[model samples]
Target chain A: MGMMKHLMVRSRRRSLWMMHFCLGGCNGCSIEIMAALTPMYDLERFGILNTGNPKHTDVLLVGGSVNHRNRRTLKNLIDQIPAPRLIVAVGTCALTGGIFNEAYNIIGGANRVVDVDVYVPGCPPKPEAVIDGILSGLDKFEQ
Target chain B: MTVSVIPVGPQHPVFLEPFQLKLVVEDEVVSEALPRFGYVHRGLEALVVSKDFRQMTRVAERICGICSAIHGMTYCRAIEKLLGITPPPRAQMLRLVWSELHRMHSHLLWLGLFAEAMGFESLFMQIFRIRETVMDILEQTTGNRVIISVNVIGGVRRDLDAEGADGIRRALKKVAGDLERIRPVLVDDYSVRKRTEEKGILAKERAYELGAVGPVLRASGISQDIRRTGYGAYGELDFEPVVESGGDCQARCKVRYRELFQSMDLIRSGLDRLSDGEIQTKSKEKPEGEILVRSEQPRGEVVYYIRADGSKHLQRLRIRTPTFANMAALMDLLPGLDLADVPLVTLSLDPCIACTER
Candidate 1:
């Protein structure tokens, strides 16, 4: 697939860590994704590294809203995160379940389970819009 | 020699939310502890039967975004006392100066996540740079910055002129001079009192028989304060409920570092009694009965039980979160501890798992 998309954009521009999850929002997008790592939206300047280990993540971020007892634990944390991962999905309750989008034990956002790749809507999105939705999910590993 | 268990959280990175403790250890201590709440239960009080009572104060300020403006001012003081309405002393000194600037930006975002769970990375970047000057004076007076939808039911949707009360008295005098230079590293730092002195104790008659509220029942000495039940404008200010007799975890981090200078002296006496009338008062009628609205949140006493039913939906919207009564005193301070002090005594009971599973 085009030389495996330039080696996944040279290994996600050489360092992307990030692993926050939350599902079922209101920690204000996990404290604005831990205030985009303090010192004013530092996001580790760009090397990004908020990890909590989804097997040493590559980008999952996610915030909340995907109920039903955490939708199979958010699909077993997006199937153990390894495959050229990247989910992003920041605030406004993980993108769509903003005001608990008709809270019948929600299932509104975090793309109903996985395949997000970058959303970052606000209701609770500023850590400079979750570091611009993680630098636009680092330009989707250059498509 | 045996017993294992561990488990920490539903997604743990020393938790921001998504609870589940488990623990049980043996060699490294912890004898038992089990906490598990519905991961962010989004059934927001059953959406009070499809949102009403003025859209349930934005679903009671999204239940928990660090006490979203005191859960929309305790659900507009229980629908302004079930619509008796009286809020115009300049919107009760602008909701007591934005609920003491959301209790000094939720106690400097819980002292920068309890100094980054006691690792103390530069006192967690100087308590988040003095909590970004109380989130930039709550985003230049409630335009939005972590859900500051200035409470509205009878009064207060937003109004704090005079240059937003001199930008909240120059941002609470630069967050009370950077919380007085981190109050001697959160009180005589010998590495934050060797990881929160006497760890998780919680005694004072078991923090009032385990019904702990706010500052973990005033750090277990219990002077009791739902702002001494004065409700809005906290009976014209001059407050006092910051007690501590060492119910441990460094007397709940010295009663949230002396209530962050007593919420900057109750927002400098609600900005010297800021006056000049009306902020919003036109609720004709719709709310009917049952009420129970208590406040004092910054992890404590947040009750809000409304029953209203004269019209626009709200038959029952109970809330009760001060981390669900401090999660039964965090299951009585997790057995004994030392599974590496279990994330510093479960983050010294500042557990707001989306306001205790919403």
Candidate 2:
């Protein structure tokens, strides 16, 4: 147990709190994130709770694309989350700015501001894909 | 009392998308609210310079995923107007059905959010459970759930056969039955009324003068519905605007709740009127003039203005989304509201930031 605490990482893996920051693309992905949390898909069954405050979050689910206006807000959100910060970039826009990449205000995807652990690709990924993407991001805790 | 400025914005538990509202509060009561935009602004209107007119359909649909079908239909209707061609009757009927289905799902989604806004977690899940039925219908019939790419310039890309239409009918009936069981909790439940009634009252005259649209306008006793303009397949269908005169948060809730059934009725009637014909008309000529096309989206009226020069691309494309029209009304209603009431009032406007900022 050198520098990394295996017990704490294992504890965080059991109950992951996700805070979704919609960074200014069409909110299709944000809606899918909610759809994933609700009954039919029920991401909560995996001990995941959708949170609002960055302070309470373990895994940050970033939706849409990164834009000039929201970049500062995105950085502010990332700064608020404590250590062991894991981010899953959901949707094509957040991955590489997708269709809106050519637009004037878009600054590209989430990685432009902060390092994203996992990138889920879709115009707006299905709820299952979002759930899968978040689960896969848990593997990053190994480091 | 000293006033405090609280910014509820680009990311909040209550909001679905990104946008900011600066509340000027004295005590816990809000005195003024200043809105901030550009959080998710992608300059979508400017994309016409890069994307061709024929390709703008995908761009238009992306404006707001909740109302994607109607946005695409409005863009196609505007293009159809410019090209001097009308979509086939069957295409129009299918468009109406999809549009109505979008309305149902959108309302269900909103109702669930409204319940969540009130902290009614169980009700939220219950409504979303019912909403899943509508989503399945959309996916099975149109081949995708949320952003179903069905509309084209001349007509719709998909066709609904007798089997598909029958499945839709059965699904809608189940939705109605589910809704009926859930109705009492939303309608007569004491807590729902306590949180909603008289919370945000926009008088009839104020709503009209401030340019409120959709359920917000109808909730204030105005019986105006753009469907009466006979766009899409509405001309062949018989329906009346669902109006409520309470002019409060509860009134807006009731308006949308009633509309869920109204949309089911509209879809049923459109299915009855579905005739055998081609979905699209062949038009080789490019559009060459200015035209304005309007349609009733789930949120409200969406207007698409297109100017073409007989070339492959358009000269200009402008959209006036309903949320834009409702902003002034929201500003007017927000002052003198309690901090706790802000979420309910804002949700009453059905603020679609993607549509507004785009």
Candidate 3:
């Protein structure tokens, strides 16, 4: 168990490869996440990078509000990512379908499909907030 | 042997929004492709019929995360015209400032995504880094990074005092400098050029024939920009549309790059010309009549049609976003390309599926 914890910390520090999945939320959260990766916020300093493949990712950042059409796809993506992986629900829409909460098409929030590890709340959270959520996930992984 | 059809997205890694692409492939070469949207549709237009004008601003901005400002601005302009109340000069200037800022950020965001699609991770990171400065300016002036909730019926809601203006100027200069350094990496880099140049070629004649707008059209050598119509304070500014002749992926990339510099210049000019005045004009009376308003969003041109019935609510609001216009060009460009090139080619149009689906 002690060895496993140390390995988690090392992996968290060296590479926090994130895979972003859009459920049904607006593209706002996704853009903000992109902003965080870009120069000004530069989340790369913490070794957080967006990975294209789910199998290689250590964290999953789910944006948008989930809907009926994407439920199965979201589950498949979650299954592809290995265990001990953290799932972050970014933006108010991902948390509770946001303003679209009342819409007939929405499947509520990201949590409805997966057990989210962290919730970063905003109409679309600022880039800084997105970075903070990733860092907080690192803390959880370390424990 | 029969060809197998593989479905990509509605939830796929390459696409950021919900849209399905059904590709019938024969040994990894796409023979037929079909796209379907509306997976995330919320019937926003139907909802707008019931909401008051003020309430609809929130809905309009929600059309797409990247082009929120232009959507809200277009919606407000349509209502303002119906009421026969022009926003104060300062308000117009502020709107232009925010609009261009949004443009810079949006283009940079797309550039980063294009780079990522091409597997150039470093370039993607670099472009995004430059985008952050614009976001900082946005947050400082408008008090929100994304939604910006600044547009009201008559004008903007926030006021940028002299100090705020000076700060914005400095931010713009810094961002412009960063963009200048990164320009070579985007345009002249061997790998980037090879991947983008000559790929997704949409000839000038074809682009015009299909009615493509924004950088996609401008890349094909057409010197058309909605801003040229002088809709905001753009008429007061000295600017020219950035045009490229290639009409390929590289040409489109160049158009966005040049526009980034132009946006910086526009912001500087707007700040210099900004004057003190009422940021918003009060209009309690119902707006009556129909007016069409068009504004250039970061992606391309956005058109809003608003009809007022002398009530707090607009009778009808129709929006035609840039992505909607570019979709035709996308379908035209997609065929005859290698399967590996699909993501890069699709992104060349800078699609905002949220805007398209909305």
Candidate 2 per-residue C-alpha lDDT over A18-97 given as tens digits, one digit per residue, 9 for 90 to 100: 89988867888988898998889999989999889899999999988888889999999999999887999999889998
Candidate 3: residue B348 Cα off by (Å): 1.0
Q: Model 1 Cα displacement at A115 (Å)?
A: 24
Better of 1 and 3 by TM-score: 3
Interface RMSD of predicted model 3: 2.1
- Model 2 pairs whose backbones collide: A24-B40
Measured on C-alpha atoms, candidate 2 has an lDDT of 0.91
What is the lDDT for A49 in model 1? 84
The Cα error of candidate 2 at residue B109, in Å, is 0.7
Cα TM-score per model? 0.34, 0.98, 0.92
Judged by whole-model lDDT over C-alpha atoms, candidate 1 comes out at 0.82
Model 2 per-residue lDDT at A55: 95
Q: Pick the candidate with the highest lDDT.
A: 2
lDDT of 3 at B283: 81
Residue range B223-338, candidate 2, lDDT tens digits = 98899999978999889999999999899999999999999999998899899989999799898998888888888888888888998878889999999899999899899999
Better of 1 and 2 by DockQ: 2
Q: Per-residue CA lDDT of candidate 1, range A1-143, in tens?
A: 98887886876866899888888887787887787788877788788888787888888888878888877877887788786778888887778887878878887888877789788888887888788777767776775
- Model 1, chain A: how large is the TM-score? 0.34
Residue lDDT tens for model 1, B102-180: 8778878887888788777888887887788788778988887788888888888877788878888888888788788
Give the lowest summed-lDDT range of ten residues in model 3 chain B.
B41-50
Per-prediction DockQ comes to: 0.27, 0.80, 0.51
